[model samples]
Target: MVAMAKKISKTVLSRTDHLLEVRDFVSEAARQFGFSEEDVANIVLAVDEACTNIIKHAYQYAPDKEINIAIVRNNGTFEVKIKDNGKNFNPDALKRPDLQRNLTHHRRGGLGVYLMRKLMDKVEYNFEAGHSNEVSLVKYLSKKQSLIKK
Candidate 1:
Protein backbone atom coordinates (compact mmCIF):
# COMPACT_ATOMS: atom_id res chain seq x y z
CA MET A 1 0.00 0.00 0.00
CA VAL A 2 1.21 3.50 -0.79
CA ALA A 3 1.61 5.88 2.15
CA MET A 4 0.18 9.36 2.41
CA ALA A 5 2.18 12.56 2.44
CA LYS A 6 2.51 14.75 5.54
CA LYS A 7 4.35 17.91 6.50
CA ILE A 8 5.01 20.13 9.50
CA SER A 9 6.88 23.41 9.70
CA LYS A 10 7.83 25.88 12.41
CA THR A 11 10.05 28.90 13.06
CA VAL A 12 11.66 29.59 16.40
CA LEU A 13 14.27 31.87 17.87
CA SER A 14 17.87 30.87 17.26
CA ARG A 15 18.76 30.10 20.84
CA THR A 16 20.19 27.14 22.66
CA ASP A 17 17.08 26.75 24.77
CA HIS A 18 14.86 26.17 21.76
CA LEU A 19 16.91 23.16 20.76
CA LEU A 20 14.70 20.91 22.88
CA GLU A 21 11.61 22.13 21.09
CA VAL A 22 13.25 21.27 17.78
CA ARG A 23 13.96 17.76 19.00
CA ASP A 24 10.43 17.30 20.34
CA PHE A 25 8.90 18.51 17.12
CA VAL A 26 10.93 16.02 15.12
CA SER A 27 9.95 13.14 17.42
CA GLU A 28 6.27 14.05 17.24
CA ALA A 29 6.42 14.47 13.49
CA ALA A 30 8.06 11.08 13.14
CA ARG A 31 5.36 9.49 15.30
CA GLN A 32 2.57 11.18 13.37
CA PHE A 33 4.13 10.00 10.13
CA GLY A 34 4.21 6.37 11.35
CA PHE A 35 7.94 6.08 12.00
CA SER A 36 9.21 3.44 14.39
CA GLU A 37 10.77 4.49 17.70
CA GLU A 38 14.24 3.60 16.55
CA ASP A 39 13.74 5.55 13.35
CA VAL A 40 12.32 8.44 15.28
CA ALA A 41 15.31 8.47 17.58
CA ASN A 42 17.69 8.53 14.67
CA ILE A 43 15.75 11.34 13.02
CA VAL A 44 15.66 13.27 16.27
CA LEU A 45 19.41 12.94 16.69
CA ALA A 46 20.11 14.17 13.19
CA VAL A 47 17.68 17.03 13.57
CA ASP A 48 19.10 17.93 16.94
CA GLU A 49 22.60 18.08 15.56
CA ALA A 50 21.48 20.35 12.75
CA CYS A 51 19.54 22.57 15.11
CA THR A 52 22.41 22.79 17.52
CA ASN A 53 24.75 23.70 14.71
CA ILE A 54 22.52 26.58 13.74
CA ILE A 55 22.31 27.77 17.30
CA LYS A 56 26.01 27.60 17.88
CA HIS A 57 27.50 28.49 14.51
CA ALA A 58 24.81 30.15 12.40
CA TYR A 59 23.33 32.60 14.82
CA GLN A 60 26.31 32.41 17.14
CA TYR A 61 24.00 32.14 20.15
CA ALA A 62 22.42 35.43 19.25
CA PRO A 63 18.75 35.29 20.17
CA ASP A 64 17.82 37.97 17.68
CA LYS A 65 17.59 35.77 14.58
CA GLU A 66 15.18 32.94 13.90
CA ILE A 67 15.62 29.40 12.71
CA ASN A 68 13.02 27.73 10.54
CA ILE A 69 12.30 24.01 10.47
CA ALA A 70 10.20 22.06 8.01
CA ILE A 71 9.42 18.35 8.11
CA VAL A 72 7.93 16.60 5.12
CA ARG A 73 7.00 12.96 4.59
CA ASN A 74 6.39 11.46 1.16
CA ASN A 75 6.36 7.89 -0.11
CA GLY A 76 7.63 6.56 3.20
CA THR A 77 10.50 9.03 3.21
CA PHE A 78 11.08 11.87 5.63
CA GLU A 79 12.83 15.14 4.83
CA VAL A 80 13.78 17.74 7.39
CA LYS A 81 14.96 21.18 6.46
CA ILE A 82 16.57 23.68 8.82
CA LYS A 83 17.08 27.22 7.63
CA ASP A 84 18.64 30.35 9.09
CA ASN A 85 19.35 33.87 7.90
CA GLY A 86 22.93 33.89 9.06
CA LYS A 87 26.18 34.03 7.22
CA ASN A 88 26.29 31.66 4.27
CA PHE A 89 28.44 28.55 4.38
CA ASN A 90 29.40 26.45 1.42
CA PRO A 91 28.59 22.89 2.36
CA ASP A 92 31.09 21.62 -0.13
CA ALA A 93 33.86 23.58 1.53
CA LEU A 94 33.55 21.43 4.60
CA LYS A 95 36.35 18.89 4.52
CA ARG A 96 35.72 15.67 6.36
CA PRO A 97 37.91 15.51 9.40
CA ASP A 98 40.81 13.13 9.14
CA LEU A 99 39.47 10.41 11.38
CA GLN A 100 42.85 8.85 11.96
CA ARG A 101 44.71 12.03 12.84
CA ASN A 102 41.96 14.28 14.27
CA LEU A 103 39.93 11.77 16.24
CA THR A 104 41.57 12.56 19.57
CA HIS A 105 42.08 16.32 19.49
CA HIS A 106 39.24 17.14 17.17
CA ARG A 107 37.44 20.30 18.08
CA ARG A 108 33.70 20.35 18.69
CA GLY A 109 32.84 22.39 15.61
CA GLY A 110 33.08 19.81 12.82
CA LEU A 111 31.73 16.82 14.68
CA GLY A 112 28.07 17.82 14.49
CA VAL A 113 28.19 18.32 10.74
CA TYR A 114 29.98 15.02 10.35
CA LEU A 115 27.53 13.17 12.55
CA MET A 116 24.51 14.67 10.80
CA ARG A 117 25.89 13.52 7.46
CA LYS A 118 26.68 10.08 8.80
CA LEU A 119 23.31 9.54 10.49
CA MET A 120 20.99 10.85 7.79
CA ASP A 121 20.58 9.14 4.46
CA LYS A 122 20.98 12.40 2.55
CA VAL A 123 22.27 15.82 3.55
CA GLU A 124 22.47 18.99 1.50
CA TYR A 125 23.03 22.68 2.03
CA ASN A 126 22.00 25.80 0.16
CA PHE A 127 23.21 29.37 0.42
CA GLU A 128 21.36 31.83 -1.71
CA ALA A 129 19.50 35.14 -1.91
CA GLY A 130 22.11 37.12 0.00
CA HIS A 131 22.31 35.43 3.42
CA SER A 132 19.84 32.61 3.71
CA ASN A 133 21.29 29.23 4.55
CA GLU A 134 19.36 25.99 4.42
CA VAL A 135 20.34 22.48 5.43
CA SER A 136 18.20 19.55 4.38
CA LEU A 137 18.21 16.00 5.72
CA VAL A 138 16.39 12.97 4.37
CA LYS A 139 15.51 9.57 5.83
CA TYR A 140 13.69 6.68 4.18
CA LEU A 141 11.34 4.78 6.45
CA SER A 142 11.35 1.01 6.51
CA LYS A 143 8.17 -0.51 5.13
CA LYS A 144 8.43 -3.51 7.43
CA GLN A 145 8.12 -1.35 10.56
CA SER A 146 5.37 1.11 11.33
CA LEU A 147 4.72 3.18 14.45
CA ILE A 148 1.00 3.25 13.72
CA LYS A 149 -0.95 0.38 12.27
CA LYS A 150 -4.33 1.17 10.89
Candidate 2:
Protein backbone atom coordinates (compact mmCIF):
# COMPACT_ATOMS: atom_id res chain seq x y z
CA MET A 1 0.00 0.00 0.00
CA VAL A 2 1.59 3.25 -1.13
CA ALA A 3 0.62 6.65 0.22
CA MET A 4 -0.53 9.20 -2.29
CA ALA A 5 0.96 12.65 -2.11
CA LYS A 6 -1.01 15.36 -0.34
CA LYS A 7 -0.21 18.98 -1.04
CA ILE A 8 -1.12 22.35 0.46
CA SER A 9 0.12 25.82 -0.36
CA LYS A 10 -0.04 29.37 0.89
CA THR A 11 1.26 32.66 -0.50
CA VAL A 12 2.44 35.50 1.67
CA LEU A 13 4.21 38.80 1.28
CA SER A 14 7.97 38.87 1.78
CA ARG A 15 8.16 40.35 5.25
CA THR A 16 9.20 39.32 8.73
CA ASP A 17 5.64 39.89 9.89
CA HIS A 18 4.43 36.95 7.76
CA LEU A 19 6.78 34.39 9.24
CA LEU A 20 4.41 33.41 12.02
CA GLU A 21 1.73 32.53 9.50
CA VAL A 22 4.18 30.42 7.59
CA ARG A 23 5.20 28.59 10.75
CA ASP A 24 1.60 27.86 11.67
CA PHE A 25 0.79 26.64 8.18
CA VAL A 26 3.72 24.25 8.19
CA SER A 27 3.16 23.00 11.72
CA GLU A 28 -0.42 21.92 11.06
CA ALA A 29 0.38 20.17 7.82
CA ALA A 30 3.28 18.31 9.38
CA ARG A 31 1.16 17.19 12.28
CA GLN A 32 -1.53 15.87 9.97
CA PHE A 33 1.14 13.98 8.09
CA GLY A 34 1.79 11.97 11.28
CA PHE A 35 4.95 13.68 12.43
CA SER A 36 5.65 13.70 16.14
CA GLU A 37 5.58 16.99 17.98
CA GLU A 38 9.36 17.14 17.96
CA ASP A 39 9.54 16.34 14.27
CA VAL A 40 6.80 18.84 13.51
CA ALA A 41 8.68 21.49 15.41
CA ASN A 42 11.82 20.72 13.46
CA ILE A 43 9.94 20.89 10.19
CA VAL A 44 8.32 24.18 11.13
CA LEU A 45 11.62 25.70 12.12
CA ALA A 46 13.29 24.56 8.90
CA VAL A 47 10.46 26.00 6.84
CA ASP A 48 10.64 29.26 8.76
CA GLU A 49 14.35 29.57 8.17
CA ALA A 50 13.86 28.96 4.48
CA CYS A 51 11.21 31.67 4.26
CA THR A 52 13.29 34.10 6.25
CA ASN A 53 16.19 33.56 3.88
CA ILE A 54 13.92 34.17 0.91
CA ILE A 55 12.63 37.41 2.36
CA LYS A 56 16.01 38.71 3.41
CA HIS A 57 18.35 37.54 0.67
CA ALA A 58 16.19 36.90 -2.39
CA TYR A 59 13.75 39.73 -1.92
CA GLN A 60 16.13 41.97 0.00
CA TYR A 61 13.41 42.68 2.57
CA ALA A 62 11.06 44.05 -0.08
CA PRO A 63 7.76 43.67 1.71
CA ASP A 64 5.70 43.71 -1.48
CA LYS A 65 7.31 40.65 -3.00
CA GLU A 66 5.45 37.33 -3.02
CA ILE A 67 6.53 34.09 -1.35
CA ASN A 68 4.85 30.77 -1.96
CA ILE A 69 5.16 27.86 0.44
CA ALA A 70 3.97 24.45 -0.65
CA ILE A 71 4.03 21.18 1.29
CA VAL A 72 3.76 17.66 -0.10
CA ARG A 73 3.48 14.51 1.97
CA ASN A 74 3.87 11.04 0.51
CA ASN A 75 5.10 7.62 1.55
CA GLY A 76 6.05 8.74 5.01
CA THR A 77 8.08 11.63 3.66
CA PHE A 78 7.16 15.26 4.09
CA GLU A 79 8.61 17.94 1.86
CA VAL A 80 8.19 21.69 1.87
CA LYS A 81 8.92 23.76 -1.20
CA ILE A 82 9.41 27.52 -0.90
CA LYS A 83 9.28 29.53 -4.12
CA ASP A 84 10.15 33.13 -4.90
CA ASN A 85 10.73 35.26 -7.98
CA GLY A 86 13.13 37.70 -6.49
CA LYS A 87 16.91 37.48 -6.80
CA ASN A 88 18.61 34.13 -7.33
CA PHE A 89 21.02 32.52 -4.88
CA ASN A 90 23.14 29.38 -4.75
CA PRO A 91 22.78 27.46 -1.53
CA ASP A 92 25.70 25.31 -2.56
CA ALA A 93 27.91 28.36 -2.35
CA LEU A 94 27.35 28.67 1.36
CA LYS A 95 30.22 27.47 3.46
CA ARG A 96 29.69 25.73 6.76
CA PRO A 97 29.83 28.24 9.58
CA ASP A 98 32.74 28.11 11.96
CA LEU A 99 30.86 27.87 15.22
CA GLN A 100 33.71 28.84 17.48
CA ARG A 101 34.65 31.82 15.36
CA ASN A 102 31.07 33.06 15.12
CA LEU A 103 30.56 32.69 18.86
CA THR A 104 33.80 34.47 19.61
CA HIS A 105 32.94 37.40 17.31
CA HIS A 106 29.35 37.62 18.54
CA ARG A 107 28.01 37.18 15.03
CA ARG A 108 24.26 37.07 14.62
CA GLY A 109 23.26 35.90 11.13
CA GLY A 110 24.71 33.56 8.45
CA LEU A 111 23.57 30.34 10.13
CA GLY A 112 20.13 29.82 8.63
CA VAL A 113 21.17 27.48 5.83
CA TYR A 114 23.25 25.48 8.24
CA LEU A 115 20.45 25.26 10.74
CA MET A 116 17.95 24.24 8.05
CA ARG A 117 20.23 21.40 7.01
CA LYS A 118 20.52 20.26 10.57
CA LEU A 119 16.77 20.25 11.20
CA MET A 120 15.61 18.56 7.99
CA ASP A 121 16.56 15.24 6.42
CA LYS A 122 17.28 16.84 3.07
CA VAL A 123 17.80 20.37 1.78
CA GLU A 124 17.91 21.07 -1.95
CA TYR A 125 17.76 24.19 -4.11
CA ASN A 126 16.56 24.90 -7.65
CA PHE A 127 17.37 28.19 -9.36
CA GLU A 128 15.74 29.52 -12.53
CA ALA A 129 17.56 32.84 -12.90
CA GLY A 130 15.28 35.89 -12.91
CA HIS A 131 12.28 33.62 -12.78
CA SER A 132 12.05 31.32 -9.78
CA ASN A 133 14.18 30.19 -6.89
CA GLU A 134 12.92 27.20 -4.94
CA VAL A 135 14.24 25.49 -1.84
CA SER A 136 12.96 22.07 -0.87
CA LEU A 137 13.21 20.78 2.70
CA VAL A 138 12.42 17.12 3.21
CA LYS A 139 11.95 14.89 6.29
CA TYR A 140 11.25 11.19 6.41
CA LEU A 141 9.38 9.36 9.12
CA SER A 142 11.52 6.85 10.91
CA LYS A 143 10.33 3.28 11.39
CA LYS A 144 9.85 4.02 15.06
CA GLN A 145 7.73 7.04 14.29
CA SER A 146 5.66 5.12 11.77
CA LEU A 147 5.00 2.31 14.19
CA ILE A 148 4.13 4.69 16.96
CA LYS A 149 1.71 6.57 14.77
CA LYS A 150 0.04 3.38 13.63
Candidate 3:
Protein backbone atom coordinates (compact mmCIF):
# COMPACT_ATOMS: atom_id res chain seq x y z
CA MET A 1 0.00 0.00 0.00
CA VAL A 2 1.23 3.52 -0.74
CA ALA A 3 1.64 5.91 2.15
CA MET A 4 -0.43 9.05 2.00
CA ALA A 5 0.24 12.47 3.42
CA LYS A 6 -1.70 13.66 6.47
CA LYS A 7 -2.67 17.20 7.33
CA ILE A 8 -4.35 18.92 10.29
CA SER A 9 -5.09 22.56 10.89
CA LYS A 10 -6.10 24.86 13.73
CA THR A 11 -7.04 28.51 13.97
CA VAL A 12 -6.47 30.63 17.04
CA LEU A 13 -6.70 34.24 18.07
CA SER A 14 -3.58 36.32 17.80
CA ARG A 15 -2.76 36.46 21.47
CA THR A 16 0.13 35.35 23.61
CA ASP A 17 -2.32 33.42 25.76
CA HIS A 18 -2.99 31.07 22.85
CA LEU A 19 0.65 30.08 22.48
CA LEU A 20 0.36 27.17 24.89
CA GLU A 21 -2.48 25.72 22.83
CA VAL A 22 -0.45 26.08 19.64
CA ARG A 23 2.55 24.42 21.22
CA ASP A 24 0.47 21.54 22.50
CA PHE A 25 -1.22 21.05 19.15
CA VAL A 26 2.06 21.05 17.19
CA SER A 27 3.85 18.81 19.66
CA GLU A 28 1.15 16.20 19.54
CA ALA A 29 1.17 16.17 15.76
CA ALA A 30 4.97 16.02 15.61
CA ARG A 31 5.04 13.09 18.01
CA GLN A 32 2.43 11.25 15.99
CA PHE A 33 4.60 11.89 12.90
CA GLY A 34 7.38 9.83 14.52
CA PHE A 35 9.74 12.56 15.67
CA SER A 36 11.99 11.93 18.61
CA GLU A 37 11.21 13.59 21.94
CA GLU A 38 13.90 16.19 21.31
CA ASP A 39 12.64 16.85 17.79
CA VAL A 40 9.10 17.18 19.14
CA ALA A 41 10.29 19.78 21.62
CA ASN A 42 12.11 21.63 18.87
CA ILE A 43 9.01 21.60 16.66
CA VAL A 44 6.85 22.89 19.49
CA LEU A 45 9.25 25.71 20.25
CA ALA A 46 9.54 26.69 16.58
CA VAL A 47 5.78 26.74 16.18
CA ASP A 48 5.38 28.82 19.34
CA GLU A 49 7.92 31.33 18.08
CA ALA A 50 6.18 31.55 14.71
CA CYS A 51 2.80 32.15 16.32
CA THR A 52 4.25 34.65 18.76
CA ASN A 53 5.76 36.56 15.85
CA ILE A 54 2.39 36.70 14.17
CA ILE A 55 0.76 38.00 17.33
CA LYS A 56 3.43 40.57 17.95
CA HIS A 57 4.62 41.65 14.50
CA ALA A 58 1.90 40.86 11.97
CA TYR A 59 -1.12 41.41 14.19
CA GLN A 60 0.55 44.21 16.14
CA TYR A 61 -0.76 42.78 19.40
CA ALA A 62 -4.32 42.93 18.09
CA PRO A 63 -5.77 40.00 19.96
CA ASP A 64 -8.76 39.61 17.66
CA LYS A 65 -6.66 38.82 14.61
CA GLU A 66 -6.52 35.26 13.36
CA ILE A 67 -3.52 32.92 13.13
CA ASN A 68 -3.72 29.65 11.26
CA ILE A 69 -1.42 26.70 11.93
CA ALA A 70 -1.38 23.63 9.73
CA ILE A 71 0.67 20.48 10.10
CA VAL A 72 1.52 18.18 7.16
CA ARG A 73 3.18 14.79 7.48
CA ASN A 74 4.43 13.21 4.24
CA ASN A 75 6.88 10.39 3.82
CA GLY A 76 9.72 11.18 6.23
CA THR A 77 9.09 14.91 6.49
CA PHE A 78 6.93 16.99 8.80
CA GLU A 79 5.99 20.60 8.07
CA VAL A 80 4.19 23.30 9.98
CA LYS A 81 2.68 26.15 7.97
CA ILE A 82 1.55 29.28 9.81
CA LYS A 83 -0.59 31.86 8.08
CA ASP A 84 -1.93 35.27 9.03
CA ASN A 85 -3.90 38.00 7.33
CA GLY A 86 -2.18 40.98 8.82
CA LYS A 87 0.70 43.32 8.05
CA ASN A 88 3.22 41.43 5.92
CA PHE A 89 6.91 41.50 6.72
CA ASN A 90 9.65 39.77 4.76
CA PRO A 91 11.97 37.63 6.82
CA ASP A 92 14.74 37.85 4.21
CA ALA A 93 15.00 41.59 4.67
CA LEU A 94 15.95 41.38 8.30
CA LYS A 95 19.61 40.89 9.00
CA ARG A 96 20.47 37.98 11.24
CA PRO A 97 20.55 38.80 14.93
CA ASP A 98 23.97 39.66 16.25
CA LEU A 99 24.21 37.14 19.07
CA GLN A 100 27.28 38.65 20.66
CA ARG A 101 25.93 42.20 20.63
CA ASN A 102 22.54 41.01 21.85
CA LEU A 103 24.15 39.19 24.74
CA THR A 104 26.29 42.16 25.68
CA HIS A 105 23.30 44.51 25.58
CA HIS A 106 21.08 41.98 27.37
CA ARG A 107 18.56 42.16 24.56
CA ARG A 108 15.62 39.83 24.94
CA GLY A 109 13.92 39.79 21.50
CA GLY A 110 14.62 39.48 17.74
CA LEU A 111 15.80 35.89 17.41
CA GLY A 112 12.72 34.09 16.15
CA VAL A 113 13.93 33.48 12.59
CA TYR A 114 17.37 32.48 13.74
CA LEU A 115 16.00 30.02 16.25
CA MET A 116 13.56 28.59 13.71
CA ARG A 117 16.36 28.07 11.20
CA LYS A 118 18.42 26.26 13.80
CA LEU A 119 15.55 24.03 14.88
CA MET A 120 14.08 23.07 11.51
CA ASP A 121 15.47 21.73 8.25
CA LYS A 122 13.84 24.46 6.16
CA VAL A 123 12.22 27.86 6.82
CA GLU A 124 10.29 29.46 3.97
CA TYR A 125 8.08 32.51 3.72
CA ASN A 126 5.25 33.49 1.36
CA PHE A 127 3.36 36.74 1.47
CA GLU A 128 1.16 38.97 -0.61
CA ALA A 129 1.07 42.51 0.69
CA GLY A 130 -2.23 43.43 2.37
CA HIS A 131 -3.46 39.91 1.90
CA SER A 132 -1.66 37.20 3.88
CA ASN A 133 1.66 35.95 5.15
CA GLU A 134 2.70 32.32 5.53
CA VAL A 135 5.76 30.71 7.03
CA SER A 136 6.58 27.06 6.60
CA LEU A 137 8.82 25.15 9.00
CA VAL A 138 9.97 21.74 7.79
CA LYS A 139 11.98 18.93 9.33
CA TYR A 140 12.99 15.58 7.92
CA LEU A 141 13.39 12.30 9.77
CA SER A 142 16.92 11.08 10.16
CA LYS A 143 18.07 8.10 8.13
CA LYS A 144 18.18 6.01 11.28
CA GLN A 145 14.70 7.06 12.25
CA SER A 146 13.32 6.22 8.81
CA LEU A 147 15.07 2.85 8.79
CA ILE A 148 13.72 2.01 12.23
CA LYS A 149 10.18 2.72 11.09
CA LYS A 150 10.26 -0.06 8.48
The list of candidate 1 runs beyond 4 A from truth reads 1-5, 99-106, 146-150
Off by over 4 Å in 2: 1-5, 103-106
The clash number for model 3 is 0
- Residue-wise lDDT of candidate 2 within 1-150, one digit each (tens)? 656348889999999999999999999888877788999999999998999999889989989999999898887889999999989988778888888988999975668999999999999999885779999999999988888778
CA lDDT for candidate 2: 0.89
Q: Over the stretch 2-116, how does candidate 1's per-residue lDDT look in tens digits?
A: 5544777999998878889888988988877777788788889988888788877777888889999998888678899999998776656668867765767765447678888
Cα TM-score of candidate 3: 0.90
The CA lDDT at 113 in model 2 is 93
TM-score of 2: 0.90
**Candidate 1 collision pairs:** none
Distance from true location, Cα of 107 in model 1, Å: 1.9
Tell me each candidate's RMSD, in Å, in order. Answer: 3.2, 2.7, 2.4
Point to the candidate with the largest lDDT. 2
Alpha-carbon shift of residue 24 in model 1 (angstroms): 0.7
Q: Candidates 2 and 3: which is better by lDDT?
A: 2
Name the weakest run of 10 consecutive residues (lDDT summed) in model 2.
1-10
lDDT of 1 at 115: 83
- Who is ahead in TM-score, 1 or 2? 2
